[model samples]
Target: MKLRRRLGIEWTGVALAASLIVCGLIYWNSLSGFDNLLYDRLSEYDRPEAPDDVLIVAIDEDSLATFGQWPWSRSRHAALLNQLADAEPKAIAFDILLSEPGDSEEDMAMANAAAQTDNLLFPLHFVFPGTNGAAFDIKEPIASLKQAAAAIGHVNLLFDRDGVVRRTSLCFKDTANGTSNDEIVWPHLMEQVYRQINGESSAIFRRLGDCQQPLLMPYANRGDFAQVSYAAVANGEIPRAFLKDKTILVGATAQGLGDQHPVPLGDGGTMAGVEIMANLLNDITADRFVMPVSTTMQIALSLIPTWILLIGFWRWRPRTTIFVSVGLVIFILSASAILLSLQIWFAPGAALVGLALVYPVWGWRRLQATSDFMDGELKNYRTETPDIPVLQVPLGPVDLVTEQAEELAHAIKHVRDLRRFITDALTNLPDPMFITDLDGKVKFVNKLAQSGVEDGVQDLALDDMLERFVAPEGLEDVKDYLAIDQELREHDYVDFTSVKDEIFAMRRARILSDEGELRGHIHYLADITEVANAAQEREEVLQLLSHDMRSPQAAILALLDGQDATDENKRIESHARRTLALADNFVGLARIKSSEFSGEEILLSDLVIEANDSLWPLAKQRGIKSTVEDYTEGAFIIGEPSSLYRSFANLIDNAIKYSPDDSDIEIVLRSIDLDKQAFVSVTITDQGNGIAEDMLDQLFERFASNDDDSHGTVKGTGLGLNFVSAVMARHGGSIRAENVREGGARFTVLLPLAPEPEELV
Candidate 1:
């Protein structure tokens, strides 16, 4: 039955997945044209030019300063063009469209002189959406000049929906003559002249030109390219030799002319219309056209990536699928950028937009299906009944049978009420709860229990669920309770290991009927491993206190019994001090355990210094050498000053206590690197009888003794080490004990460094 349901889900997923794949393929087919259009637009926006041997004749602020206001007379433009002609460039194409004739006869003469150059190709303006919705029109005289110049093409620019000029006119319609002519666009007038000089036909326009091709001459948007001022050119300060054969563009470049267009290559501002035309001509002349991606290919590429993402998402968990989807999108965007850099156009915005829409829709559908399935299952459970009968009938007298029947009916109602109560109680419990029948099949599970089940495991059996989610020891205890067919209830906790390797404790109880019939087992898991360990620790400390207190008490008792020498009084006093120190450790432990320790902002360096000072006298008496290594110049920590001092003093005292007479003890206080999180570590290492490797593991454990032959032989209570550990823990720090390689015990206490209040602000 379960296999059939699973098969149904799989079939549904597969069928829907196939539909999405087919839809993606269809969408790809439809998107080709749009993507191609985008590519064409992007190509027009890209800055294309050969890296070297190209000089931009910029019309800059400097040129403006030299030439004064632009729209210089046509005679001056002719002179500038004539000067450039001396260089004998391969081609020269005019970026300026001479839509209007010059102002005077001398200007016309100069324009006619520039136009007479064989290499020059003038720009023609083919205006669209003409005035009063009239038909597109081209300047009549400008078209006539096409016959005189080398070549003439329309200069119509296009901007994106956002009003950014990213596309330039590559081809335009000549509606004036009712004929459509697709003409090649050039970067500048000089390029067209260079091409004509080299005897190259305009047919070479279809291919990208190499470095050896016609030079790209750039015109600064402010008309700065012209070397001599208009006055100088007219006055013959600019040599006629310079204008003899050059291609020159004569157009207005003054700011108020309203002839500027935005280009990404320019610094976030509009370039002069003439300069933009100049850039386009340079791009074409150099054969640096943006590589166009066909419409069909764009759609195909977009759809393929989308389908791959959907299929991967269908197979993986939600979190895993989300990560994979995000990563794939990033990869696609990065690839698009790389292609764009290489002059290959791709539709990044369209593709990303499509995926972004599809993924959320797909995920929502999946979640909806899962939710529907769960709702149906719950409905079925509510309407269904278990096979087990609530009660059995027995033979009896008539009156007794009648009364027994009423009693039985009442009992049935009572049992139903009890079951409802049990269900409600289980639902409200914070801990996870599960009940399995005598046959080891799951009878019911609470909400928390369902949550505990791993993702993707919908239906689970009792044994399998236990083995997978519950700890091994807990599972064994559960099985034992089921096998005995008896009620097993206990406050004892068993550690359950989760899939993440974290341990949790489960407290279990087996449910049974009043007649001693096995019904099912109920388990409540409480994650109290930390708390359990703390309780066990407290018990051990109490035992250690008893043993440590006995030694001092025995010495005092002996002194009272007159069993000492002439130094009895002094010996008794020393013993009393040792006892008082032991007692103090217990008091500190209790204070910390009860949350009574008052913490303050204290300098860790000062505490270390104080600890070293206190231990120096003891070290001298024991004939042990000691050194304090302070690396924390002024680092501070938030902790109880007395508690912290006592903790360090205890460690140092222990080092002095265990070290051989005249042995060296090193106490180092330094800050450890924790990836920008500062921590102060105080290390106390002693050349003493080092702890055994096995004993080191339990060194911080309360009442844990090192003596294998005799338990109480150690002079001090084990509570001292436990108390030290407690104090460190209270300060959000930790202590570890280890045996050094050179035969000594080392104890390192790590504390979090406190920041200054001013720094916090």
Candidate 2:
């Protein structure tokens, strides 16, 4: 069944089962005397009127008060019977047994009195059930009294577990010295009296059918039955009108006899055994009984409310269903009370109890189901992940289905909230992420994880930990697999190339449980393409700078070979300074666009002078004339001063190297206007074979030079101009390399003029 509807009937079934178990337990306990509560409750119903045909000549407390205690001679009981017979009663039934020839003459007197009175019935004391666990009657009536009676009937009363007399056996098995036929199947004293007076079989016993033959008996009234004192009857004080034609019972109602028992109709004190028999016989004769309602019928009636409750849960609100169930139970109970009032028996506690438990059991079941559903959803998202889990509780027991779903709902809500938080944290992360099982199978992959992977990639496999993708031929695996400086191999990480040549840093971590056992892997893949490229470019630039710096070292060695020691020493000093200047330039170029962005005003002439001073020794070694037309013009910009000096020095040194021996190299500074903004311009002209008209555009590019064909004597390192261009761009300036019409090359530098002192303010 779908959970929603299963929810309705599931708990209802639980209620029915639990209630049945409880009812059955109670029924068993009642068999052990607890059921007296139910029977005692039934006693609250109205009772039948006493059968006027039967009367008790009670041997009461008042009789005991008058007749001097109990155990009065059997001759005294015979006197009562004979006196009762004189009134022409239909039958005189004695509740007392004339057993054991006590005072033989007195016993003979009682027996002789019974023989003379034709309608007197003597008590046959049979064993089974009369006294608990005894097999046979202890003391039956003596031979004389037994022969004198019209019929011998067993007064074997049946008491319920609570010690209350609710019924009497219709027949008795007289396992004693009694004759066969009717004596062998001895009848109840009440039944014998009933047969003698009514002349018909009891209909109440027949009503039980084939059920376990326990008859339900009801009393006619509470307390005293129609009676006269036994002493009164025996002394002839009771009038004949009170006993005439009546079925008089001569039995002990005296307190000293201890023959009293709780009956269905008595108020509190025990009813005398004789009175109990009187009530039974009277009840039988009047055809009044409390027959047990058939189990089939009771079950059917119970289902009425059960179905109502189930239907309400299925179609209506739980509260309404619960109210209906309770109402139906009350109706059944009220109807049972009415039936019992009319002296009938009915019990529907099972159904009432079942419905009572339905609400909570159902609610608890739904709570568990909801928790399981939420857990399942969390483990693997059902329909796309929910923003907030909508977990709610079903109906409950006392809180009824609808009335008290709040508590369970809150419980589910709490768990769902936790699940949502975890899901959001894992799935919505900016970095591409994945979760894999212990077997190395991909269980989950976040959006970024999938998007960052190459087109053919879907999952990560354990076997490919060290070799995720094929390496290109001839690239050192050691350099590519491991970082440049590190020797340790990181097999749990992989760097794969995307179709767009993009690089992703895929790192995997082992997820472990609390006990430190490996659970799975949490892989995070991030796009590191730009970062990787920048690192490669920086490495290449450093290699180039290291190689080019050897040129100044070669020149310093060449100076030591000069003939004059002074000139050689002077040139060596200049070459050493030049080498230092070149090192500073490489450092400045590398540091230009870095985080240090402090700027200040520097004169244009100062930069030119510094560049010329550093390059003058090189010009002298090359037999070249290099001159700087220094101008004190405030030609500067708001930029790093060291980077600016490096840029100007690059242009001057290039001019000096490219010019032939004794060739003129002039450095001129001027001011220009573009877009109404003042800019400082420095021009360096080299008078040599520098007319490379086809390579002017590529001149400032890294590794581009006039020696493209390798035919020129000036071997350019090709990085200095690129460095110069980059440094100029960092200062918001421009560079130009052109063939001067006077048969040489001219390189121009243009920088924006720094604002005046007032403008700074």
Candidate 3:
């Protein structure tokens, strides 16, 4: 929720900033004043060089003083044309309007002179919203003069909203008297003159889409064009050689003529109409018009810097954003100036406004969102863990954000205290304890664990940590035990001798997060040196009893066997063998108890047959034949080979011992399912006196044997059945003894079946 709010604020800022720029572009005319101001300033430095071949013949104050009043007659203009013709100027543009018919002789005289002049041009003018309902009216010189001139063109200037002449139209298009079906187009007066001199349309005029659009014109410095008095040129006071091959413009520059207009020269002044025309002609010949960017491009560019700062708000600090905002302003202006130099105008006002508007507004929104989020979180924190006392903030009138910050600091300090408490408790644990993360790198160690490791043990791999503490012989055992999945391991703890020869039982448990994510593991090592040593000593004593007692008993059986026909000798031999069997049973029990159970796959049918065959001699002596019944086709079980062999031998031998002479003993191997688990069962039944009802319960118990009432010859050792029971339990199996209804005792053992090799893999 908090993240959403912050993103919401950020996107809102983006929309607001983008909307401002787009709207500014949409209503650009109302916002173009500053753009024009900037253009005027930027363009001054990139003014074009004045055209050297073009000269202005100004009818200025000095020219008026010499030529009399402003309405100079056509006869006078005729003389001027005749004199310029004598000079053989390359092209002459008569900028002064001569639309109306004047005195016939005077006009005819001027027309005749213009007809003689080579490449002579006359001016045409337009009156917009013309007489009647026409869109515009075109004014041209009388027919005689127009027929005489090489070409006649319109003299029109394009004014911006500020009434400054910054642009020029290369041509004008209108329907005749706004009533004719066909449209007529008039080229600019300078364009006509340039065509006469160069024999082709100017590149600037050619690039226009419809010859009606106005293009931004770059100006040369004021008064940069060479000028001469019209009276001197007409009176032949100037050298004719100086005028040769020059394109000349003849117009009024006198202050009294009312031909002056405002222009963008970075000065609060106006330029003469003739000089403005000279600048326009220079631009066409040089092809130096400034092209404006399209509207789509304008809005796209305007949004760039604003979005840059808007996205930066998420990652940059307020101070850095402020500096970037200023940089964006400079960047916008610099871009405009650079584009201006390339003869392209990209006004920077809309972009500057976007950058300026978005910075502070976004700053406010971001701060507000953050403050609200923090306030909500702090309130919830205080409410949820009320027992954790929050420290009081500074006792003064403080802003909400500052107060929230103070509360957050207090909460952080309280968490740190709780962490310290947990650390202390773990440090003082009685047993060696350590923690490791998912990567098996140790992260924490109790004091007892640290004592066994070097300083700076944290962050060491679990294997490296074990190397420092565990004995070399026990390292692989511990590693293999740890490698098993914790939940699936057979035993919860494994014992290993440390480097100091102290036995420790290591146990591990998972560390889970509150969300039940498995974060790491905690290992505890409990010292069991004394317990392990006592068990070892017991096993050694059992080893002494088994070996030392069995040797003399076997010697007695060997001596008795040589004299076996006598009653006393047979009795001695029976006693000696019983003692040997007792010793073996006791030792086997001790070994199985002390050692770990390591198992291999053994075929149950084959092992049962082998056990029966080994006891066949005894069965033959008693005239008891044991028949093997194989119900199981072939079955295997995982168990210790020695123990399982001994266990099966004990059960079969007991069956043969109790059976009557020549009575058959049955050994059956079969597969059965107990509960839902698969197992192989071995049953040994003897044809003899059945177990007494009271002795059946204690048949497999240690020292609890059933007396052989039917045979009454030899007493059985009770240790065998107990040892068999122990081995069955170790192999995840069970043994049961019961009397069959018809006769003798029946012993049954069930062991879990081993999986196939493919299943194991």
- Tell me the TM-score of model 2: 0.48
Number of clashes in every candidate structure? 34, 9, 1
Model 3 quality (TM-score): 0.62
lDDT of 1 by residue, 1-761 (tens): 43345545654564466445545644554454444344444444444442222223334444456666665555655665665555453345555556776566755665566565656566656566677676765653343356666666555566554444555534443435453564323332333443555555333354534322322222233323343233444345655556544334434454665777655433456766655655554555554544545556765665666667666764788788778778878877677767776756666655565567657766565545555554554445435635444443453556633544544555566568668777887877776677766666677777777775645233457778777666565667656644552334333555666654545676556677845666766667665657767866976776666566656676675666655545867667666766767677876787678655577788887777788888787789868888888888877888998888888888887787778888898988898877788899989998876776666667777877453321112333377788898889888889988778888888898999887688874
Model 3 gets an lDDT of: 0.85
Judge candidate 2 at residue 465 and give its lDDT: 29
Task: Give the per-residue lDDT of model 2 (tens digit) for 94-174.
Answer: 888767678888888988888889887878775544455556545667888888888777787787766778866677554
Better of 1 and 3 by lDDT: 3
554: Cα error in model 1, Å:
99
**Maximum-TM-score candidate:** 3
Model 1 accuracy (lDDT, Cα): 0.61
Better of 1 and 2 by lDDT: 2
lDDT of each: 0.61, 0.68, 0.85
Off by over 4 Å in 2: 1-16, 19-23, 26-39, 128-134, 173-184, 205-212, 294-312, 341-343, 374-761
Clash pairs, candidate 2, are: 30-35, 127-136, 127-137, 359-396, 359-397, 360-396, 360-397, 395-401, 623-662
What TM-score, over all chains together, does every model reach? 0.41, 0.48, 0.62
Cα deviation of 23, candidate 1, in Å: 10
